[model samples]
Target: MKKPRLFNLFLAVNGLLLGLLIMLPILALLLASSPVEIMKLLVDPEVLTATWITLLSSFCALPLMFLLGLPSAYGLARCRGRLRRSLEVLLELPMVMPPVVAGLALLLAFGRRGLFGELFSNLGIRVTFTLGAVVLGIVFIVTPFFVRRCTVLFDGVDKKLEEAALILGATPWQAFLYVVLPVVKRGLFAELIMAVAQSVGLFGAIVMFAGNLPGRTQTLSLAIYSSFESDPQQAFALGTLLLLISLLLLAAVHMLAPRDRRL
Candidate 1:
């Protein structure tokens, strides 16, 4: 092995420090709670319901994202022009903004007096304080994760594969499903896991848009907040539950990461 340079040594130290800083809070949260209390909270109706809502809502949004985001991500990946770049920037706008601001934007856009609100009201749909609104808030914030990941994965795929499929008379949709998706399946999983994770822990936007009504739209994070105010032990227990789910999902993603398989 070659000897490390001075700069490499410094880089190693910096990376170690960063790792410790990030891991400390997670370790602390875990250490502060007991297994029994965590299980108890998990079985509690209020906590269980919110956890279900967060997980189900996140899972529900993923299919919609796949159906819609896949085409957009693929198009953005393949395009080469200033216009495409501008559009990519625009799609990422919500990601760069504050979470509360993003929620507020959703509220105004879908709220009582905004543009689509009047139309939705005419159709007898009240989004405010509804589960649909929670899903919308999640999709708004998490779509970028899916789009960004899929776009990069699609870009890396050799365009020749698609060309060959096209040459064989496969239609565009068929080519993508069979030829393209198989290659980027791992990245898609990573994006899906991340999107679900974000939606699971989401507090600001869901609370703002969906109004934290128990058994209506109360998500895990909101439940945690409420518990924190009312019952500290239950709050930590709920938090420990969220932390475990997140950690497991991340571990699964790591295990599923593609291992140098070619398309």
Candidate 2:
């Protein structure tokens, strides 16, 4: 046999093995539950409440990301030199930081006795152990995903189009709204969907920051962890749902990605 064919065969087998390694556990868990079991789990009040809380918290974080994260991303993309580099590193810290560490930082920054905590406390604004904390925890961890993607999306867009719009007498805001945003809308949509998917499956950070309290701060991931030992069926049901959504989100990302960027 030819050496090139042998190398290609090796690569194919290696890739297949890695893909299975990533997906087999999820596949097994999904198969473990029957439709009837899933239906029963869905009807359970605890399950429903946790799902709703997770969805609500995720929804809250989504808009905030669009409002704040997009502008930050645009600035990062347009800037260069030491300031940009410093800002990028700081923005990326949460991605590499342990969720527990991130949660601890959040606690110190917002907890009752920590810095700025007294300010919130004085105003009778409670953030810890609440749905708001869950949203904050999620946003802290996931905003980077959206920002990084949007930065890339904006960077990839042709500046000439914006310049042309400006030369045509359009205001800066109008140019961005009508020209730049439309060009990158698909990528933005994909990033937002991926962020939501990530939030639904988040556990460690949310657990540390929000402290699971059923019907309040308990997200789907936390609920699954709590139920897994005592109720494997319920855990499987939730896991299956999350797994399906994750797969769908991934597919959307791949479909939306440019041909050159797609895996």
Candidate 3:
């Protein structure tokens, strides 16, 4: 009894410390500006453009993630072997790799003078320092997050449900659509919220690959950095808006997510 009580007390202290460590800085940012000052920054055209660009990039990248990642995640979920582990780890590299390093890799592969520059040029496309490349970078970094989440979600789904659906004369696509997708709907939605938050906070990759060109590649994170460098007052205001937006997105996900028996 004494041992359990001591362990619980230790955990409580550590948890409180961790929570305070995380919240104090956010609290400081929130208290940095007056309401009127926050409103002015919230209304700034450049800031507004940045917000729009961030949303557009997230939208563009999310589809790509679904297109490319869903198939991979599905394959991973249904397979079991040595190759599966290798493949999954390879895909997870992006998550473990530093964003700055990932950005540099993009620069090497798609930069104006790098490996794929001529290939892109031949196709009448310039990916680096462009809006499209910003989208690409965002996708590259975030796709793994969604894929991993979905893979786990799919793994948790009972295998019997799929077999039952097929036995009912449903095609593979139909089974997936009607049975698997519906079962994992809550987890999928949660993954989306996580992906969106990650995309919103993207900074190093966008700055490196896209160069933070205003109205084109600048995102909310970039806007925050630039605003802080230019004017702390406005920066804090933007921070307030950012914090509020993040909370809203999280709340939406939490409220809308369907309850499920999580494994």
Expressed as tens digits, the lDDT of each residue in 214-234 for candidate 2 is: 999998889988988898877
TM-score of model number 3: 0.93
RMSD values for the candidates in order, in angstroms, are 2.3, 2.0, 2.1
Write model 1 residue lDDT over 173-249, tens digit each, in one string: 88999999998888778777877777788778888888989998998889889889988878887888888899888
Error of 1 at 41 (Å): 0.8
Against the true structure, candidate 2 reaches a TM-score of 0.93
Backbone clashes under 3 angstroms, per model: 0, 0, 0
Query: Model 2: runs farther than 4 Å from truth?
Result: 1-4, 252-263
**Of 1 and 2, which scores higher on TM-score?**
1
* Global lDDT scores for all candidate models: 0.86, 0.87, 0.86
lDDT tens readout by residue for model 3, 133-184: 8899989999988888889989988999999999999999999999998988
Q: Which portions of model 3 miss their true places by more than 4 Å?
A: 1-4, 258-263
Model 3: worst 10 consecutive residues (lDDT sum): 254-263
